[model samples]
Target: MIERPDDAPGAGLSFDYAGFGRWYDSYRVEVLDPALVEVEAVVGGLLRDALSERDLARIRGPVGRVKSKPRAWRKLSHRRYVDRIDVVDDIPDVIDDLVGIRLTCTNRRDIDVAREVLDALPVADDGRARLWLAPDSERDYLDRPRPSGYRGWHVNLGLAVDVGGSRQPVSCELQVRTLLQDGWGELTHEDTYKKDGELPPLVEVLSRRMADLLSTLDDIAEDLRDELDRLDEAAVTSAPLPLTTETEGPGRRAAQAADAAAYLGTRWRALDRPVDLAALAWELQRDHGAEITDDWFGFGTFKRFLSSAVPAAEITTGRNAYILPADPVPEDDAADDAGADEHDGDVPDGDVGGHAESDQTTRHGTTGQGTAGPGTADEAEAAVPAAARALHRVDRTFPLLGHDDWTRLFDHLAEAWRRTGAQPPTDRLARRLIQSTRDRSAASGPPLAARHVEAVVRDLVAEGDGVPRPADELAGTYATLVQQRLVELRLIGARNRNARAAVRRWIAF
Candidate 1:
């Protein structure tokens, strides 16, 4: 979709610097230097904002620079249709046409981010941006690599701005990347891999190996950076400790210790005081060391210890844990209660109260009637028969319901429960309805249909009934119900559907 200018060779006029430099100097001062200065300032400002101080410090020289060189008349002179001298003299647009800017970055990812940032910037009236990953007009050393074997990201941008009241197109190349990659590229450029000729087989192999190593190093560095961010987030919410040092230590080991201590301290502070501070300290040290040593601790030893040592009520992850006042009823439950009250006198049959319904159901089919009003028992039993008929009807109507149709049906059931006094026949009935709706919807059209079912499942599991579950046990129960329904509907194939599984699958990693 992006329209690029045709760059076929010999399509435009070229000029010899020896003859044109003198004549062009008389008419127009070289403006490429000033344009480059402007680009450098912009790029440096962007880098400062996007990168941390440590990363910024490592960058060598200016982030970007521009260069201008006149093409040889012989190279530029060839005109399939016109002489080079005539082409230059007749074409007034040839002056100030050749310009380039090179940007150097620390790593490939950084280079990508930099390119995105630059492309997002407001463009000049006549400027267009283009990127070249390897050697091209801007950088031509890919075939003949440098000794150090560094590769850089380069961009050739053409400016359409009018200079000195003349309508002329100018080109600038921008290069970006990490200091390490830049260093490697520079070394390779200077040493063995200049553009003179084809490189030796040994040099080629070595260059490729070095390139792989550079990529691996970058990946490792990025992972470390991500871990550091996680540690920082944990640290901010932690309580200030009297025994803790004000200055955090350097490297991964120290970061891990600080993060562990901070996490434990924050979580434990909500409990009664005179806490086992020494034990906490020991746990932090042990866990921190274990992460680095990897072999020091058994798989779940540290986790188990932390869980047992801390108060279950105080320990929270993935979701918040707050104690609600006793008898605190969730809004949806309250709504359900209010709805149930409206149908109190209208009990289906054998209904002593709503509490008895949950007691009758078991993993295996054993139906013992709880204390329901004599009037409600007949209706409740009749409702079950009606639900069975409805399920049979749905099965016949849609033989192979996909994911989305099943979701829609379940949504319909849930809405029906809320709006009307109709209760689903059983949890099994609700599960079937969900699956049938989801399947029908998926079979309807686009590939996103299945994804939509997944989204709804995720939302239900994450924030059930749009109310926060205060206790882990309560949350786990609701999560399990949702997971069970999803599995029954074939939306989520069975593997693991425990508390930890729910957290890992639904919550953002």
Candidate 2:
């Protein structure tokens, strides 16, 4: 346990921002680092032993971090705390949450269970532990959030460490929150937007409104879980027979399952280009006894099936995987040539592999070199999709798409624009999407595969019900309508030679 000295010579001295800094640097290296390591080891081991797999899955993160040096100094420099202290000596004595762990859960019940587990843990004689419930001000936020819209529970614990035979207690803080509260808090983090712990009036009002909306969403999630449970019970009683009964042998069943996904995938690509994921999910539940949730992995499985079956699907692995439409063949070739030419000419003076190149320009603006530029092409070509996807506000529900699904979509869009002799949409959303892909590639490496533009077009398209339909029916009608529109435009533009040329260029493809 860390204890402050009361009778120091410079007791009650004014805040010395530099004085605190000098001691903290050395203290951190010699004392804080080693102490934190031991405490974390103890806590981590305790958690591993105590929690079951199901309990562990319920938790999002049990991440621990030492309070950064700068943040520590900022706390100590405060006049109120320093004024109470006699010559502020140590960082730990001033800041209670020197080492901290944060845990996020899906609901209030999970939060309570986690807290109970922590509270029941054993502590050695050398250590001291204390847990503080949020005071009235904070409690109100949990029940009815504050103006800043922050809602979470905080607990502070101090564990004793033996440094060269003497036992010293180091402080650690634990924060617990529901998933909804955690998401809102992260998006509007105090450190990111608020300086000096103050929010502008407008920001405060908006945040409060967001908090209310988030609370409503949380309630909806709870309702959904309840409704799903009722549905699950109904499904148990009346659901179709097991999929295995549909075929005679296990091998045949497996083959049929695979074939079903492929057949459905073909229809989806031809009709919608991108698979109608919701329809796919419904089909799986209705026919195949597969339960799909809205989580990343659940949706990812759906995408995986679609990608395998449909030429349009794209898939990626790891935490931030996603799918989008594929790139056009001509646009891809054009961009590849452009990227290759740029790479050859633009190698910086010192770096070997364009390492020193900071801002490599592309058709999408200044993304680093070796990147496919933005709009549809950019999404398919991004080496790291997470950063780019975040920038574009892409849905994060699915972790992977059918492989090359995004590539096909991009290619079709590019081809359509080219054939029409009209530019593809280059609005703010498109630019941001492109810029993000480039930025991600620059930071990371090149993408897993260079998106291929040339892919076979299928005649069968999937309906919203995930059923196959003939593309010829729609294609013939669509072509005739477009031709009529083009003729009308040509007749109107007959008076202007330039307009005629533009119209001809558009329809020539």
Candidate 3:
């Protein structure tokens, strides 16, 4: 019988092929290698195509990899079969994560969205190409996390591929997690610590603490997204355009700005990430003197322009990465200031090269002519005190921050009140700002730093007057006039026109 079975598959009669490394290599080269690429491509394409452009922008990566042969061998070696067999013959049964996809998104919402998309995907085989999707392989790890504070959604897909002229089922694990969760996992590598042995007491405690904090930050991100959604709905329904003006010149400018805002709002609404379009339009007009007329704001032109101009939300795994909710637009160039409020109403024409109209202006000061020119005027303008520049930047950044953030900003402003060399804040908002700043200082550890004070001031100026609308409309009209008193004291300075105007506008609000 032995002589007759000399050339049989498992002729050597050992399940552990310790000396059959060459046969394993032959199997890898002949069968597994080609199938790896096919399986990976099919699975990866299915997962990546499920999300739209907007969702894709928020997520970081959808990386894919195939399990290596040595790892597969180690897995197979751990198994004890009832009868002797060839290692290559048993490779298919033991390997599960031979092909894998790891999807890392920016936030919790995206991870959830991915989960839904994967659940509905149809699985297929290579040769006969049968299309079928079977359930019961997914684990909801986010909802039911491990005792070790690990959180992610794991999906094991059983796929069949044509390997060596036969249909073979391959198991692939797909893991979905937020960027933050993935970062934590990489920092405290489980293989290095957990797999090695029992965790040390201090390391265990720190890991739990880190997990809790990251989880809280994730919750905060989710809440922030919800708040933004509420804000967008409010903006579309009732928030009035901020471009109110009566004079023909200002009114024309206002109309142009409104059109631009409307266009942007409509486009973003379709993607479910609407911004405060009115606020954005107002800042572009008032700060940079941008001309958002029909020629420039047309569908074909504006969409392409905004895609490049508007900065996207920067996603990161750190806590301090939030640099205000919206992107900041630079202040207007001097050339644009030369044609301020020009009543010609021509809707100026060109290739629409820049956001603001370009022209030559006298530099020293405002000319007797209606428009200001470049020269010493621009030099003087540029030489405005650092405080004014700082304030302008703040206004640009914070014009639409929430009311609570503004309140915290007011507290900081009061702490720096003495530094401004102006009369102590007497108006209700100013007094409240100072009082709150003091109260917070008393409660917290230390007074804010000089840079922080400047940041807070800019945020206050950016906010202009209220959380959404004017203070009276949003907060029932406060009695204290903070910015009005500051203007009366001339603390904002007239060295910079934009800064001075922004301070006055806040007073009006």
User: CA lDDT, every prediction?
Assistant: 0.37, 0.43, 0.43
Question: TM-score: which candidate is best?
Answer: 3
Question: What residue runs in model 2 are displaced by over 4 Å at the alpha carbon?
Answer: 1-15, 38-46, 122-141, 192-196, 229-509
Per model, state how many residue pairs clash.
52, 30, 18
Taking the tens digit of each residue's C-alpha lDDT, what string does model 2 give over 363-477? 1111111112122223223222121112111221211122133332333333332333323223432333334433333344432211111111111111122222233332343
**lDDT agreement of model 3 with the native:** 0.43
Indicate the TM-score of model 1: 0.38
Q: 1-509, model 1: which lDDT tens digit per residue? A: 11223343333434334455565454335455545555566557766654433345445445343322234222343343324235445533332223445555544444534443443232333233321121122332322334435556544544443467654444455555566666666655533243334467777667668776876787787677557544433332342322223332222245454465456546555432112222343345444642422311211233333443343423223321121111211122233334444544432222111111222111111011111111122222212211111211111111112222333334443443343333334444344434543554335432122222333333344444432222233324533544443233222234322212422222111
Per-residue lDDT of 285 in model 2: 59
Return the candidate ranking by lDDT, descending.
Answer: 3, 2, 1
Q: List the candidates ranked by TM-score, beginning with the highest.
A: 3, 2, 1
RMSD of each: 21.2, 24.4, 23.0
Every model's TM-score: 0.38, 0.42, 0.43
How does residue 282 of candidate 1 score in lDDT? Answer: 35
